[model samples]
Target: MMRIFLMATLGTLTAFAPPAHAQQAGETRLVVRPSPAVPATPTPDQQAAVLERFARARDNLVALREGRRSVSDLSPQELQDVLDYDRRVRGDYPDTRGAKQQCIDDEFRRAGGRPSALARQVIALKCRN
Candidate 1:
């Protein structure tokens, strides 16, 4: 009777043991949980920095649009520089993403230039293409 009881207890314990796949060759296990708070908003200084970065990105885009500069003409490093500036601006000033493009389109329209087609192309190129 005692042997049977010991066998049952051992069987239950083995069943509750961690799975083989859960064990790494040389790592300890840890449990992680997501926090329940919203991320903090950027400060005023960060907002200004974001605006400046966006302006720099816009200037690069303008140069690329004009014959004064070419995307292909830029070196790999220069291309990366532009992309990094764009990412920084987007990270901090997400609301301005479409707004800035709209502003540019409005300017062109004010100048009596039909810019929807070009604006679409620019948006495609800058954000996706």
Candidate 2:
């Protein structure tokens, strides 16, 4: 038992340690372990607040995207496709980080334009937590 405890302790320590590597010029790294999350159920008020904020952010993002898209450029079907995708994402992944936003931004660039407002909101939503 004592031997097993020591091995486990050593293994955990190593897991928390930085890599042993030669530093490059101006190389820097920061490592942090966040506190373990306590999954407490949200109160009614808390849930309401979260929903309100999410709605505001989502509306703002969609509005920005609509503002940027000229009605003539994107066909009605394409516009509906984008909006439906947006809705599905929101419903399917309410707590999800904006992992798809990078793809969105990349496509936006390939098509030639700045990051859309919706893209920015995606990043912002992830940061809110």
Candidate 3:
């Protein structure tokens, strides 16, 4: 009895739902579908691509710290911006790469050397021999 009452109440609620503009406009109803499942592991090519990108970004960060690169397109903005902000908010700019690395090393230490899955992969591939 309780189940039937709940089903009836649900049916009534659905039946009285505000009409969609699509229905009023006489357009085809949109079909909802789940996306395909992604593979648990990246392909070799995908891994290589990520490593390549990481190398590029790391080089860019180094260059930015050294004033050897343009700041217009800092791919990993946090690499420089966070350190810049921390200093500016409390101190000033013209900080060294050692300062930036210090910030990152501190953060990496805070994570107990356990980076995110992506970071872990990068560290294993790039940071490690």
- What overall lDDT, based on C-alpha atoms, would model 3 receive against the true structure? 0.67
Q: Which stretches of candidate 3 lie over 4 Å from their true place?
A: 1-38, 73-129
Better of 1 and 2 by TM-score: 1
Q: Give the winner by lDDT: 1 or 2.
A: 1
Compute the lDDT for candidate 2: 0.65
Clashes of 2: 0
Across residues 1-129, which tens digit of lDDT does each residue of candidate 3 receive?
999999999999989987666457657767899999986898899999867766665666677778887766654554555455555456776756665466566657766876798775554454432
Clashing pairs in 1: none
Worst 10 residues of 1 by lDDT: 120-129
* lDDT for model 1: 0.73
User: What's the count of clashing pairs in each model shown?
Assistant: 0, 0, 0
- Best prediction by TM-score: 1
TM-scores of all models?
0.31, 0.25, 0.30
Let me know the TM-score candidate 3 reaches against the reference structure: 0.30
Q: Which candidate comes out best when scored by lDDT?
A: 1
